[model samples]
Target: PAARVVLVERSPEMAGFAHATLAHPGNAHLGDRASVLTADVMLTGKARGEAGLADNSFDFVIMNPPFNAAEDRATPDQLRKQAHVMEDGLFESWIRSAAAVAKPRGGLAVIARPEQLGALLDAIDGRFGDTEMLAVHPRPEAAAIRIVVRATLGARGKLSIRPPLMLHAETGNGPAERTEMINNGLASLFGD
Candidate 1:
């Protein structure tokens, strides 16, 4: 069954496309069990506030936010601050919002690039407890390119690193395993 999810995207085109492609198919079995909301991460007041979402309502919050350092460099300017820099602290705001709306012991999962790991950890530290890390390697021989992290609210625990997930084929078979995982929702294999 699909859990209640609130997906935020800055681009309407990407959001709508995601709703049509991913949400529709991924939640087909859990009809009316999912809700997809499209809005800019920084400007969405409802999402930032509890009025738009019930307290302790969700089971999980999943996202793959933008990860361009040049675009969101740590700077002091306002526009860049909100857009790229965390001046407006949109990522932290969203994380807090997720923690607020998520049920006790609910999980928050994010897939971010390797470079963003430090910022991500800094942003999430202390706010959400029981953090765990899973590195994502593009190929067996290559360094990890991305990371998958899961954290829960209000509980303290040691961080556990999982085995790296190899996404690309050694012989360059066009990411065979990763492709299947994306196309067929292979995450279900983990049984949550």
Candidate 2:
């Protein structure tokens, strides 16, 4: 059977955008394999289950939760600010939800600012293991802008950090080959 996806979105506009994107002719197959549920992701496991996120059912969970500190320069737009700013306990809540829904040995992947890696790891502790992180740098000499973390539920393997992914060429403005490949969906952070 084809893999099915259940997307949870809190914003009506985003939900509508998701639906419209899926409904596009080029994405008909994806639409057939996916469904969108409009709801708060911060809800309790039981509440989420009631909203169609059954516990111990999903084989994989991926997220790009807001990681910006409240003190970070806020976006002028309220909606964008809300989407980019992180609230207290956000990581814990999201990871708790991920753990609840994922089957044993299920995979969890997250994209976050490099500074949030510690918080993310702490939240995953005792729930997901065998964690690996890949740093995303804007250029060869620049500090990492983001990190992609991957882990497996119920596994005990030690954490590992993968090679950094450079988005831009060492000295040029254009994107690196790998970055282009990844942007085009031809590659993955996990090298899978």
Candidate 3:
């Protein structure tokens, strides 16, 4: 059987769009395996369960939470602002919710700006362990702009910083081969 997936979105419009996209003919194969849930992830576990998220049920939870600092320039568009701007303690709140829905020994993966690494690790400290980080660089010599973290719930392994994933080449040709492969779903950033 295909793995069941639930895409939780706070924005109703975005959730509707996701549902429609998943229901489209092009995604027919995935239509039956995935669902969209329009609900606030900040809700308490019981509240979330009432809203369609079963507690301690998901095998894994993957998220890309807004990481922009409040001091950053804000977008003029309300929707964009809501989606891209990070409010106070939002990161921790999201992590808490992710942990709530994850099963014992389940995994959690998060991608965010590199600056958020410290906060991210702090947020997941007790809830998820065996943390591993992968830096994502724009080019070979460039500093990492983003970091992808993977951790297992209820684990105790020491954190490991894996090799960096370069998105672009120094030659300015285009995306690196690994990036292309990942974008096409032909490869995973963390190998199986």
* Each model's total of backbone clashes: 1, 0, 0
Candidate 3 wrongly placed segments (more than 4 Å):
none
In candidate 2, what are the lDDT values of residues 1-192, reduced to their tens digit?
A: 489998888888889998888888998768568988887778885788897788899999999887889779477887777688998999999999999999999999999998898899999999999999999999999999999999999999989999899999988888999989988989987787
The TM-score, computed over Cα atoms with residue i paired to residue i, of candidate 1 is 0.71
What C-alpha lDDT, on a 0 to 100 scale, does residue 190 get in candidate 1? 28
Worst ten in a row by lDDT for model 1: 79-88
Taken over the whole model, the C-alpha lDDT of each candidate is 0.66, 0.90, 0.89
Candidate 3 residue 174 C-alpha distance from true site, Å? 2.0
Q: What TM-score does each of the candidates earn?
A: 0.71, 0.92, 0.94
Residue 50 of model 2: what lDDT? 93
Model 3: per-residue lDDT, tens digit, 1-28?
6789889999998899999899899999
